[model samples]
Target: MRNALLAISLIAVFAFFLYVAVNPGDFGGNTGDHLIFGEPKYSDMDDYFIHNGQNQTGANNIVTSIVFDYRGFDTLGEASVLFTAVLGVGVALRLLRRDKNDE
Candidate 1:
């Protein structure tokens, strides 16, 4: 009975997510408006980045300028997360090896 209840709840949650994914509402716009899937919404920020990114960052490549200068903090956070995951896996492997040697 508990397993059946859990399965039903999971299915409900999945359905909710699927519905949301299919019908994502327009961002920063009026209610009841929907955005087409995979279509990018143009904003002032995008225009500014395209026009001024290279001048501001002195990077020849726009993508490099955005990643290294415009979004530095976000890039840092991603690198930190990747480092932490690698450290965690290394520690887990060491602990498992130590347990094997003890037996």
Candidate 2:
């Protein structure tokens, strides 16, 4: 019964996502912009990055320039979080092994 309920719940969640993807405007999407999938949204920030990211960051790759220069602190925080998670997992594994050996 639990497995059946889980299956039904998963199916319902997937259907909800599918509905949202098909009719995004129904769920707080901008009705004024009729751009479909794969269409680019032109913004001043995007224009600035495309034109001046290389000059500002001195990086050949625009993506690298944006990640390392524009969002450096945000990237650093992400790396810190990932490092913490890895350290936690290592500590947990060591504790588990020590406990098993103590038995």
Candidate 3:
């Protein structure tokens, strides 16, 4: 229970960083009309698909390709960041790497 709370708190801190990512000009005090987060408006590329045994490229599924291949570097970075955070928590809580020779 305590560990879950700690994890949630850490994630909240990271999510709050989005304040810096979203410009004030983007929101402009209009709070009720649209979403504040995510892909900025769900572009067309998000809905692309395939045909008989081959996928179409004229519509050029940039978003799909990015999430799967070209942007995989970023994905790997995100995974590493999560791993680092969990490892940090484990160390902080003394859940791992304890010195066996110590009292």
Question: Model 1 segments beyond 4 Å from truth?
Answer: 1-37
Candidate that beats the other on lDDT, 1 or 2, i.e. the better one: 2
Q: List ranges where model 3 is wrong by over 4 Å.
A: 1-64, 95-103
Look at candidate 2 and tell me the lDDT of residue 67.
97
Compare the candidates by lDDT and give the number of the best one: 2
Which residue pairs in model 1 clash with each other? none
Q: Clashes in model 3: which pairs?
A: none
Q: Model 1, range 9-103, lDDT digits (tens) per residue?
A: 99999999999999976665644444545456678998898999887999998889989998899999999999999999999999989988999
Estimate TM-scores for all models: 0.64, 0.63, 0.37
Q: After superposition, how far is residue 102 of candidate 1 from its true place, in Å?
A: 0.7
Write down the worst ten-residue block by lDDT for model 2. Answer: 27-36
Candidates 2 and 3 compared: the better one by lDDT is 2
Question: What is candidate 2's lDDT per residue for 1-103, written digit by digit as tens?
Answer: 9679989999999999999898766443444665445456778999899999999999999999999999999999999999999999999999989988999
> Can you give the lDDT of residue 5 in candidate 1?
100
* Best-matching candidate per TM-score: 1
Residues 1-103 of candidate 3 have per-residue lDDT tens digits of: 9789989999998877776666445643445756665336655554533331124333355556555565678998999999999999988668434653354
Q: lDDT per model, in order?
A: 0.88, 0.89, 0.63
TM-score of 1: 0.64
The candidate, 2 or 3, that scores higher on TM-score is: 2
